[model samples]
Target: MTFTYQMTVEDAVSFQKELIHHTEEHERRRKVWMKYMRAILIGIGYVGTLFFPYRPESTALHILTAVTVGFLFALLLTPLLNDLYAPYMLRLNRRFLQKSQTWPKETTLQFYETHVEVHSVSTNIHRTTQVPWASIKKVNEDETYRFLYYEEDEALIIPKARQGISEAEQLEIDQTLEKYLSTSPNV
Candidate 1:
């Protein structure tokens, strides 16, 4: 079977966001620590607000307040900033790291018995990659896309809205992926 779709910077950023969400869900200890840290920062902020006009004798409190506020600002703002900056960062990474300036290009995937071939083409670049079925570490899907993850942080994004991907085709792809991935020890 074959499927083709547009791959854009927006798709890359969305994948990054999805990866972050997935990581957060799986990292329970990290989430717990972040929650505790947020609580500590908020408590410090409250204490600092209560003693805003610190006397000369309260030099330590003034310093603590300054430190706590800085941490609080970073803790609260980092995710927001990341969301805002991710698109630009992905674009830059594509241009410099991947050395591809043209994106939002057509990507085609062809599934064979033993491997999947991916072809991506733009004005200045044309590339094809063949991934053996055994090399796929995982197959995951959300509402809008199917992710064929070959590594922890990398995947082949197959958008469900692509023209050739009908419901039956999706089911076939899912079955094919399941058949291959279920046999792989890494998954």
Candidate 2:
């Protein structure tokens, strides 16, 4: 069966936060790169004093030079790295978005069950993919949402609205997930 839906910003944010809570620390490695970028900017400020050939006017230039360099570094590095890892991260993000959109905005989570099949919204490209229930590996519930993990620890979050499923239905899905492996909602 296929379900169609859209998610609001609130739903998306809730799902992202819950998934982040449940995700392995390794999945958040982006923060390490972010910290490295911050450290490099600090280093740039130190070097600017020696190499910028400009006198520091109340440390404002130091701050500006460091910030400009850091902003550029983040802009350059984020795209390049995201591109290199695009396919894998795209899959993960897609899963999360799909799950979050499983139910309609007007629906109460306890009123219905949802099943979905997503086709990427592409304007000029031809592509196709599918994920059957059999492939789902795990289900984890957090304070605000649920993460359905599949394919090598990857996961998708189910927003409360989409979870339009009753707690009983949620448990039913959990039972199904258990057939693939043990299930838990630790996040």
Candidate 3:
């Protein structure tokens, strides 16, 4: 199944919000390179604890070991800060696009067995892009729209509620996408 519809600036704004949310989700689920850093830090901290004498004769060295471990532990805990800031960044993105901006006035979409080709048309822009199934890392949906997330900067948003697609039709489309994309929608 294919959908050809032009999205309004409001829809674009919603797309932006979903992108932000998807980013946060990706960060949470994606591979964390920090694990290696944390392991190295812990190992160094442990070495310090083992080599340094913990006696009154070596008070400064004992303090140095404690400080090193504390500092490294602090560094290990820094990723949690991003979780705290994600919601704030999401809110800021919503506020940033308070004014409506122009989006593609029309789009031509062709859903294939494992890819979707997009031809974009707007007053200012005209381009065609092909996104393969492998590039689609995630499929997400909200109450009103389904988002096919390719990357942080690219996604295809289908307005499920606006099209007034019948439930049977929606189910069939869902099954088709699920078959190719390997992710099922909550729709």
Runs in model 2 deviating more than 4 A are: 1-6, 18-32, 44-134, 152-156, 160-181
TM-score of every prediction relative to native: 0.61, 0.39, 0.54
Query: Tens digit of lDDT per residue, candidate 2, span 8-97?
Result: 545555555545445565356656645665566556555554565665676777777766765665565665554444344445765676
lDDT of 1 by residue, 9-87 (tens): 7666567655655553425634554566566666666566556665445768766666767577657854654454435
Task: Name the top lDDT candidate.
Answer: 1
- Measured by TM-score, how close is model 3 to the native structure? 0.54
- Candidate with the greatest TM-score versus the true structure: 1
Q: What does candidate 3's lDDT look like per residue over 1-187, in tens digits? A: 6667776666666776666555656465333434554665666665666664454457687666766785677486668644544455556665665543445368766789768888778767788878898888777788877888788667887666555456676677677686787766643
Ranking 1 against 3 by TM-score, winner: 1
- The C-alpha local distance difference test score for the whole of candidate 3 amounts to 0.67
Q: Give the Å error, residue 78, model 2.
A: 20
Q: Give the TM-score of candidate 2.
A: 0.39
| Worst lDDT 10-window in candidate 2 | 107-116
Q: What does the lDDT read for residue 94 in candidate 3?
A: 57
